[model samples]
Target: MEVKGRVSNSTGTIVQSEDEIDLRRGPWTVDEDLALINYIANHGEGRWNSLARSAGLKRTGKSCRLRWLNYLRPDVRRGNITLEEQLLILELHGRWGNRWSKIAQYLPGRTDNEIKNYWRTRVQKHAKQLKCDVNSKQFKDAMRYLWMPRLVERIQAAAATATAGSPTASASATTTITNNNNTTYNYNNNLNNSFEVHSGNMMLSPAIMNNNFGGSQSYTPENSSTGASSDSFGTQVSPVSELTQDYYNNVTVVNSNNNNNPNPDYYPQVQDQLSFLDCITSPSGLFSQQLDFQSMEPNTPWIQSNGDTYNGFWNVENMLLFQQLTDNM
Candidate 1:
């Protein structure tokens, strides 16, 4: 086809620029496809204008690029998305929203267009099969249940950060809070049950450390009744007192009274405890909460916990406590 075109700048004046004036067309051949793919894989996508020139392809940069991506790419898996792939697409789309590219990341060899189409067709089909409206209140409710734990974890993490006073406090508190929140949120939202005892223990370490630091100055007894009260409260608050002593011992200046200090051994004990806590509370430790205990499906072993199976009152109370602790952290 002999195509005629005029090129102009913003002012509507006919510009004689060679870059704008030149136009090319024709069916892409094997040689063109090979050239385009080789150039792209080496140099990477984008800069389409330069691609046509440097790659020595007669086709326009747009056509060469589109052909390569939509058909000629080696990784492009050309087939219908299988049932397994469809489920993955639905789950990923539910979690990530309209992040088609990210969804593609999970489905190797699948194009964005393929995933998008599969979602539109298969999501609706499955929704109808389940006798539910894809855009209805129930569908949204289902999605909420699906993604709630992740959302809750993020909220708790933010709360922890806002309440944190020092870098160590902030880092340690945020991690602990997030871990606990993830456990609690997943258990409550998925399994519809109260999480195991470990949730409380997660908060115990950070709480103890904070309390110890806050009470450290009151370690010595004074003649005043106020001083006596302070010492009583300070000693009684072992967890908090231990944390404060550890913090001060790590950072505080040593003085003439250091040798005579009543709690000279306190800091080392707290430090040891902190190390023990750190060893156990690794990032992977959170995954245990995600185990689907009631799973019956052999291939897809993770079953979503139904709300009807657990006590509503306890769930509400636990969620409230989680929110409150997160807020005050």
Candidate 2:
């Protein structure tokens, strides 16, 4: 195929190739994909136009490059993005605005096009559902508070299902919950590094359950063997305490000296009467807290519904946002 052209001077004139071979366009075929792959594999990539000609691919340099990078590349990950990937995209987009290329750097194996499509389709659709601009603060808050928690729960549930075949846990199937009284916490307003994760049960550092109740109470599973009794933290914890250990699912605790939790003055005014579901489930309203991402524990795992441990971060608002999701999923 030849493309005839005309010539013109540089002073507001058009110059074209006398005869240029026409390049192919539109959808790539299997042969083209295999050709691109074999060419890159044998000769490596560079000078893409020359590569395309050498490989006998009827495509332009730009077309060849786009096809290779966005579609035929061996490393390009396809299918639904994981919850972790979605969270990272959301966090990065918030930080860098619409710089999709830069955002693509953080998410390995994902192309900028994929992230943009997801945002425009799912995220923008949600914003439209709420009748708000995609760039509005309300939409961002919805992403932060609602969608993130949902994703984390889904991730946790999936991970748990995957690991369900592992060895039977000592704590699983026992309606009688155990509390490691040896376990201690900092139920105070300063929740940085509240408590370290131990062998079983996600432990609360400063006592999330103690905010409204009188005095600090730590539930130790070891001593939880006997019938309920008033013990260490000055509150009554049951052996099969409705508030069991898994209350701290997908919770990301920071080790910051929270001079800025935003809710330092806010106090929880609840009764001692609580259940396992109560501790993990989100309150009726959105609970806001100032979170400093610097203090987070990297790659910390959470316990899923089946007593299996899985890795994911708490969305950093309130802990119970995804509580109901475990059972529902």
Candidate 3:
């Protein structure tokens, strides 16, 4: 009966905890945000646990830290990521893999959480929709050859529009794509290797995206206008499933002494000098060394190539050939 009586006065018997005040959770309130910001402004950042306590924020240290680093920081940049920023994110992500914090270091004012969100929501969404592994070889190829070019085109388009509106911008805006590395860039392609297809408008072939895409390798004037002379066009079955796909899109190779190819058997065949650097630019060593591409079913139509188009899954041999053709291009 005594124990029962003791328990009956729940409020009286139980000593109030030091943190008896209400602890807020979930989305932050304007007042709470102001409190956090003002407290940080006066005291500066760090010592999150003590900061939260002294700041009068009814939140955990981690919560306060996250809000400050991700949002409240004076330098933090929000809103949609620009094309240049997007390219950097992809490149940095490729180099660092899931190291969001490390990747964020390269992007000024961009938060790790923002980068992670962009990768998961925008980048991985494509892979998920395609039903392919985000870390597969096929998917990587799609990103390099398909998606990347699309990003480049968008950047160029935006630049052009901006220049047009100002009228003071030069044609150099379109021709000069800043190198990702601090060094200079000069693209091998004359910016007209083939059809100027936008990523949003272009249709991707399922067969070409499959791991066994080889049949589509035999691209010609009827298929790709990549400026490859008709005589230079030849069919070669390339096992891209094992082939090395260099992520250094248009990374310049410096062979000095004013010399020609010392070894004709070198891996990448030497090509004619470029009038300008490859439009694509990325900070060197920013992305993972090289990642395998993931690929799956095509949900859209393929561009007309010699009147041969795929409406569904491809045959094994044809799929392989398609991959080879894409590789050749």
Task: Supply every candidate's count of residue pairs whose N, Cα or C atoms clash at under 3 angstroms.
Answer: 6, 13, 36
Candidates in order have lDDT scores of: 0.39, 0.45, 0.44
lDDT of 1 by residue, 1-329 (tens): 42434567799987665653445566655566656756765676777868987887765678766675556543344434432244345455655667886666554445677777766775565446445677655553433332223322222232344234222221111111112223211111101100111111222222322232232221111211111111131122222222222323343323334232222221222221222122123443321234221231222112224311112212444344434433454
Stretch of 10 with least lDDT, candidate 1: 190-199
Count clashing residue pairs in model 2.
13
| Comparing 1 and 2 on lDDT, the stronger one | 2
Name model 3 segments beyond 4 Å from true: 1-21, 167-329
Query: What lDDT does candidate 2 reach at residue 287?
Result: 24
lDDT of 2 by residue, 137-219 (tens): 76666565555545444443333433342332332122322347644432222121121111111112112322222223332
Rank the models by lDDT, top first. 2, 3, 1
Question: Candidate 3 local accuracy as lDDT?
Answer: 0.44
Best-first order by TM-score: 3, 2, 1
How high a TM-score does candidate 3 get? 0.49
| Model 1 bad stretches (over 4 Å) | 1-17, 21-31, 38-47, 58-66, 121-135, 140-329
**Residue-level error in angstroms, candidate 1, position 211:** 46
